[model samples]
Target: MRTWARTGSGLVLGACTAAVHLLLALPVAAALLVPALRPVAESVVCRLAGLERRRIVVLLGGTGGRAEPPPARALRYLATRIPVGLLGGAVLTLLGIGLTFAATLLFSWVTQTPWVMEREAAVVVSGLLVAYYAVPGAVLLYLALAGAGGVARWERTLLGRLLAPSREEQLTRRVEELSRTRDAIVAAVDDERRRIERDLHDGVQQRLVALGMLLGRARRHPDRAAELVAQAHDEAQRTLVELRDVSWRVYPAALDTGGLAAALESVAERAPLPVRIHCDLPVEPPATVRAAAWFVISEAVTNAAKHSGALRVDVEVAMVDGRLRATVRDDGRGGADPAAGGLAGLARRVAAADGAFTVDSPAGGPTVVTAELPCA
Candidate 1:
């Protein structure tokens, strides 16, 4: 590179320098190698000239010469290797220089020009041309190569010292952590199911069982039997609805092969008030995304049915701009607060999936729950 700088023109040298710098910026120096390659290459050329070496020392010192020096041993090693080293160096350097010209030839052809013209121009150019231009450019690239090699050496040593893992290994650890988190989530869901089951057996289920007995006994009351039967029927119906909801919360069957639409339809059908469903989304959404949509809609529908007191509910779902958008609004009651447990859980779940959840429940009867999810 130093020799090239001393001999070449500015434009060519400048390009060489830029390329060297760019390569050095990378993690590995790769082709940025020591001058040793020059001689080894030249040895092949020497064979044609019928030259022979007893043995060749590629270089004088250690690979990068970072080892501790032992003067006596070093002297002995150098003395023995110097003659062979010289022959190797001359052979390789000549080869390197020759290959460099070969490369120039190929480049000129690829560029639709002639190498002879460029070489003539290079030969005519003065030190000022070479020094101020080409040589400087070559030097820049050489320095970059040296610097990159030094950096790679440093990185290996540093990583060894610090015991840092490779990129893939670190990511593997992260995946394991996320897997643990998912496992915990599954466990917590199961626990919640047990609690809901207990609540049903202890609270709503027992009430309905008592109601059934009351109605049976009511048949014997001659005077107020008609009114008693009516009350019992109403109570039983309410308990049955509550029981159905608990199971729905545990799992939504419609979320399977039939997809989100089916699950959503079931929600609307189950709600007490009339609901208009507007679903023009893709028939299938990703499982997690689809599940998120299902939960969010189910929550919104339940909220509308119980609190909004609205006469009609509108549920709209569609994928817009690579996102799943769902809007649920009720005309019954207007005000809803996010701090409430129901909406809060929905918000957290959507956020976990890197989606957006919002509620626009204004006072006085039009409450809209809007959730936007990135399904893609």
Candidate 2:
């Protein structure tokens, strides 16, 4: 009942508003013909058209963006809308005539006119009278509603054509976004390469060199070779571990074989601090999103364990509305900065996958890192 009342009120209000616009459009059209009055006429038509647009959108429930049209388009829209407004006025007139007939019929029956003779005949006449007004009334009501809806649709379509960005503008924006994403991906790849080279040269390469020296010594001294060989074996194992760590940093093998859940589990297990992981996924995300999620979680855990003097860390990963979301929080001495080396690289990696990365760390407590990767 309430909805019906509201809809009826909107239709009435829309009809009245349209009628007023029909009256104003004449002066605007006349002013447009005179060169001296063209500017003022254009401005007046634009303002009035804007008000009408808002009325249709807000009151009549039309779909359109809140954007203003150019002066020429506004004038053209106003000129075109006059016919629609006149039609609305005609609908209102029909409704008024039907209502008048109904009121007169009710008044005559209430007053007990002399010609109303038998109760049966009076009742039958009343039914006929009702049909006389009701049929046209119902038809006019439908026409009014259809007209209102048509006007609203037309207004929205015209507004979109006049105000929406051009195809060239849309393409330009898309190109710029792609360029920025490409640059971010390139920078992230270069940073990863440099870090890999540094790790190999400083850690694994040096260990291999020492292992060679140990083996060379063992070959020269037969008795001491036992202890030298043991040292060489230990060095070789350390080098292998370093190489594995580097490989994991590049891409976690668990992600490919075990999926996102097992990959995150590995990160939790490897983290120096105690980590509690909560992951709920109905189905696996795409491979690209999986890789980005793994990188973010691993990097966040490592940063928290190494930098933050935290007692515990919590990680949550979930798939929501076709997007993979992960959050890592630690109760540590906060003040984590995204501008720092590790976090900056993490941000770039997330961006490469068209994901959002956020860091929140105040001066004195828990630090939170969040990432959202689009899987759809």
Candidate 3:
């Protein structure tokens, strides 16, 4: 039906154009006579002479811009400049018609017909041939314009189809980006852990060992060494506290002991900012989930205490449909863009344990980061 409608429309357009043509050409004598006045004839002759002169000059002078300006100075000059162009085109068209006649005359001669006896019949035949040639040209011109429009529409549709991402491809691309970001974060974390370990070993641990030796030497002295031994004892006690702190940071014992719940509670208690904890867990979660929860809580609490200008924070942990759900909400100014990098590390650490994470932070005083880890 659509094709039929288009075909009908094209037929109507073609018929209208043909009717207009027939109306214009109805008076053929007038069509061929109006542009043949004396001035028009003279203009046509001048243009032919100017064109021939330009061609000869260009050939002789090799286009060196060296020729005197070709006769360009009158109404005739104006004709040479402007009307000349139209006049020349008309003469060329007439010449082509003359050539067609000459060819017909030659054929007539070869067939032993009279030299030019049937002039009226020859003119009518030539007119009919020119008229028929225009029909297909008009059709082709219309189809060309239509085809160009269709091609533009098709190009637009193709571009739209190519640019839009498919769901599966979008997921695949997102997963790839996640993998790259995760690997970079994990590498950075391992580097930081190693640095911290090295610092403790070279600095604090060495100082602690020296302090212990000093305490042993003070004990060996028998004369008036009690005060020295007491001072050494104080130093040794301080060193032990530092060592334990560094040890806890390497891996907290509570994470392996009571479970993620108790570990998170310890983190909350340790937070410099006021912290509220709500926990409703079941059977302590899986080992990896437990570890993830512990780390997330630790890092969140540390970040809140250190940077977030918040007075209070809330930590919530619960099992919702076998998934370990935990959230940390801070009452702080909170316009966070994850692309700025810190949260990327948090994201990967959770993802490594096969968890889902979300962050919701408004402009002021209420930021929530929620995580869900597979209990399995």
Model number with the top lDDT:
2
Which ten contiguous residues of candidate 3 have the minimum total lDDT? 60-69
Please tell me which model should have the higher lDDT, number 1 or number 3.
1
**Poorest 10 consecutive residues by lDDT, candidate 1:** 52-61
Question: How many clashes in candidate 2?
Answer: 0
> What lDDT does candidate 3 reach at residue 334?
84
Ranking by lDDT: 2, 1, 3
Which residues of candidate 2, in runs, are more than 4 Å off? Answer: 1-163
lDDT of 1 by residue, 1-376 (tens): 6532322222222223324433432322232243655444333323311111111101111122212223332223333333333333333344456557545655554565545537555433333433454555566557544543343333233223222344565799778867755664565466556658787988688878879887877878858788888888888888887777777776687788678888888887878888898888855779888888888888788788887778888999998999999999888768788868678767766766767888888789688888998877
lDDT of each: 0.60, 0.78, 0.59
Error of 3 at 7 (Å): 41
- Residue 127 deviation, candidate 3, in Å? 86
| lDDT, candidate 3, at 152 | 30
- Residue-wise C-alpha lDDT for candidate 2, range 123-238, written one tens digit per residue: 42355665676777777768766765665566556556654546776799789988889998999899889988998899889999999999999999989999999999999999
Off by over 4 Å in 1: 1-195, 202-245
